[model samples]
Structures are given as C-alpha cells and as structure tokens.
Target: MKWQNALKDYQLYLKIERGLSENSIENYSRDVKKLMVYLESHNIDEAPTTITTEIIQGFIYSISKSVNARSQSRIISGLRSFFSYLVFEDYMTSNPLELIESPKIGRKLPDTLSENEINDIINAIDLSKPEGERNRAILETLYGCGLRVSELINLKISDLFFNEGFIRVTGKGDKQRFVPIIDVTQKYINIYRNEIRNHLNIQAGFEDTLFLNRRGKQLTRAMIFTIIKQLAEKIGLKKNISPHTFRHSFATHLLENKADLRSIQLMLGHESITTTEIYVHLDKSHLTNVVEEFHPRRQSLKK
Candidate 1:
C-alpha cells in the first residue's frame, strides 16, 4: 500500500477506534511523515508494506543525531504503533518494529513550585491592568484545579458547579471528570467573572467559554504559556516552569500532605495509577510518614 494511504487509514483508526484527540492524532501522524521525508530524501523507493526493519533503523539512527533520546523514543513508539496497526489489518504478516526497542532513558521528574513560590507568582500580578484580575483567576484555576492548559482555556462557564463543589473537566480524548473546586478558587473566578468577564463584548460562539482574550474570544494555548512565563520572569523564579508545572505542584503537594495516590490519580484524570506514582518519587518523606503513621510495626514500637 501507498505510504499516504496507510497513514490516512491509520489516522482514521486512531480517531474512531482509539479515540485519540486531534492533537494526539497529529503527533502520531507527524512521526510517520518524518519517516516518509527520510525515505524521500534518501531516494529509497519502498512501500509501507515492503519497508524493512533495516531502513527504519537507519532512519532512527539518522534522527538520533538531531533529536534528544526522549524524542527519538517517542518517534520509535509512534512508528511501532503504526506498524502494529498494519499487522492487525492483515496488511503485514508480522510487525517490523516487534524486535526493536525504545532507547533506555531516565524517568525525568517533573518540576514543582513550593506553596510560597506559587503565592509570590500570583502576588506579582499587576491588578491595575484590565486583564490582571483575569490573569490572577487563571493562575488560581491552574494551581487550584491542576488543570492541563488546554483544559483550562477550554473550560466553560456552564461547567462550574459551585453549589455542588465541583467543576466538570473534559480531559484528553474528550473524557469528562468532575474535579472538586476549593472555595478560594471559586472566589477568584467569581471576581474575574463579575468584574472583568462580565464587561467584555464576548464573541457569539465563545459566549460560554470561561476565559477570553481582550477581543472576547477564547484564549490560545500560547497565551497561557506567555502569561505564566511573564509571571515567572516578574517573580525572579529560577526554575523553568509552564502551565503543567502547576499540575505537578498540585499532585506533589497533595502527595506530600498525605493525600492518597488513587485519589490524586482520579482527580488528575490519569488512566493509570502508575502515572500518579511519579509524585511519590518527589517526596520520599511522605512515604516515610505513611509508614510511621499507619504501619502496625511502627505503632507497636510507639506503644
């Protein structure tokens, strides 16, 4: 089969069968496109079905020189998924990537902001500007809800269930979950809504969108990044941080405070408890505390 046809079919399967989000589908497709580009540039005439492991290996080797190990591993994983799809469809008898292994890499821990640092960043916002209240609310929501930047921007006014003490979040793959919203977070959001958002001449389609730009349209992902970056610079924060850092901080803080991993996993909308386990590595002291507080042997010794 033609490379283009195979990729097109794979994209459809990812969307319909795997239920991947558009962003995820794009990332997966890009990996295949990179291989296609490599093939064309090298004048290698090979169909998707006929492409050998050696050619794929050569492409990976060439890419390793230009990209980091993490990126290289992701590309390999993406290609492996694509080939596995082909095998499932009977396009190939065996997967070419079955024998290939992703590069061994260390588990890079996420960066987290201390409670004081987070407060400093929020405090640094200039309340004089028209968007200042909105910005503060945005930061509060980010740290408070531990939302992905995409989820935060796409949040709608109707999603707020304050009386019920929850906000419905649509996470990756359009999966919805209700996350508990604290009173402080609700107060800041209410301030922005009443004082700032209420005054904007909101565009027709974005009427329900929670966060809007000065033009009264939905905020872009880059806008969120820019906002946080400027805030970090203003506060003289030494560590590099992004919107995701707030999420990491939320999980790490919860773990440090003796919050159960399973609950954090549910709140974070992680599919696996393994994903939430990374926070355990962030604070070994929390684990020690758990043993000291609940271990029968420790309790007996204390008695």
Candidate 2:
C-alpha cells in the first residue's frame, strides 16, 4: 500500500478508534510525514509495507544531527506506534521498529514559579488598559485551575459552575473533569466577563467562549503565551516560562501545601498517578514532612 494511504488510515484510526484529539493526531502524523519526506529526498521508492528497518534507522541517523535526544525519542516512538498499527492490521508481518530502542534521555523537571513570582507577574499587568482585566483573569484561571493551554483557550462561560465552585475542563483525548475553582479566581473571571467580555461584539460562534480576542473570537494558544511572556518580561523575571509553568507551579504548590497526589492528578487531568509524581521531585521538604508526620516510628523516636 502507498505510504500516504496507510498514513490516512492511521490518522482515522487514531481519531475514531483511539479517540485522540486533533492536536495529538497531527503530532503522530508528523513523524510519519518526516519519514516520507526523507524517503522522497533520498530517491528511495518504497511503500510502508515494503520499508525495511535499515531505512528507518537511516532516517533516525539523519535526524540525529538536527534534533535533541528527547525529540529523537519522540519521533522514534511515534513511528513505532504507526508501524505497530500496521502490524496489528495485518498489513505487515512484523514491525520494523520493534528492535529499535529509544535514546536514554534524562527526565527534565518542569519549571515552577514561586508565589511571589506569580504575584509579581500578575501585578505587572497595567490595569488601566482595556485588556488588563481580561489578562489578569486569564492568568488567574490558568494558575488556579491548573489548566493546560488548550483547555484554557477552549474554556467556555457555560463551563463555570460558580455556585458549586467547580469548572468543567475538557482535557486530552476529550476527557472531561471538574476542577475546583477558588473564590479569587471566580472574582477575576466575573470582572473580565462583566467589564470587558460583555462589551465585545462577540462573533456568532464564540458567544460561549470565555476568553476572546479583540476580534471577539476565542483566544489562540500563541496569544496566551505572548501575554505570559510579556508579563514575565515586564517583571524582569529571568527564568524561561510558558503557559505550562503555571500548571506545574499549581501542582507543585498544592503538593508543597500537603495536598495529596491523587487530588492534584485529578485536578490536573493527568491520566496516570506516575505523571503527577513528577511534582514530588520539586519539593523534598514535603516528603520529609510527610514522613515526620505520618511515620509510625516518628513518635517512638521523639520519646
């Protein structure tokens, strides 16, 4: 079969059978596309079913000069998944990537902002501007709700159940979860809604969207990053941060304050507890406190 045809089928399967989001499907497709491009540029004419492990290895070797280990590992993983899908469908007898091993990359810890830094970034916003209130609300929602950039951008006014103190978030794979909202976050949102968003001549389709651009449409992910970047610069903060930093800070702070990992995982919409455990690495003191407080031998040792 043609590589393009196989890729098209794979994307459909990812969407329909696996129930992955569009963004995820695109990322997965990108890896296969890279291999296809490599084949074309090298004048190698081979279908997906006929491709050998050596060709794939050559592609990996060619990319190693340009990409870091982490990215190379991801590409390898993506391609492996695609080939595994082919094997599962009986298009191939064996996977070409089955013997390939991903590079050993260190676990990169996420950067987190302290409470002071978070406040400083928010405070740097000029409240005099028309979008200031909206920006503030956006930051508040991002940090308070521990939302992913996609989740924040897609948030709707109807998703807010203020009376119940919960905001519904649709996370990866279209999975929905209810995250608790603090009163402070709710207050800022209300300010933005009543003061700024209400005045926008919202486009027809974006009527329910919580955050809007000047064109009265939903905000883009890049727009949110730009807002945070400007704020960080205004405050003279040096650490490189993005929209995800707030999420990491949110989970880290909660863990520092003695919140359980399971609860943080639920709020952060992590698929596995292992994903949430990364935050524990940020605060060794919290673990010490846990041991001191809960360990049965602690009381005996104190006596």
- Candidate number with greatest lDDT: 2
* Window of ten residues with lowest summed lDDT in model 2: 294-303
Give the TM-scores of the predictions, in the order they appear.
0.98, 0.98
Per-residue CA lDDT of model 1 for 135-200, tens digit only, reads 999999999998999899999999999999999999998899999999999999999999999999
Query: Model 2: per-residue lDDT, tens digit, 13-97?
Result: 9999998999999999999999999999999999999889999999999999999999999999999999999999999999999
What's the CA error at residue 5 for candidate 1, in Å? Answer: 1.3
Please list the residue runs of candidate 2 whose C-alpha ends up more than 4 Å from where it truly belongs after superposition.
none
User: How high is the CA lDDT of each candidate model?
Assistant: 0.95, 0.96
As a TM-score, model 1 comes out at 0.98
Total clashes for model 1: 0
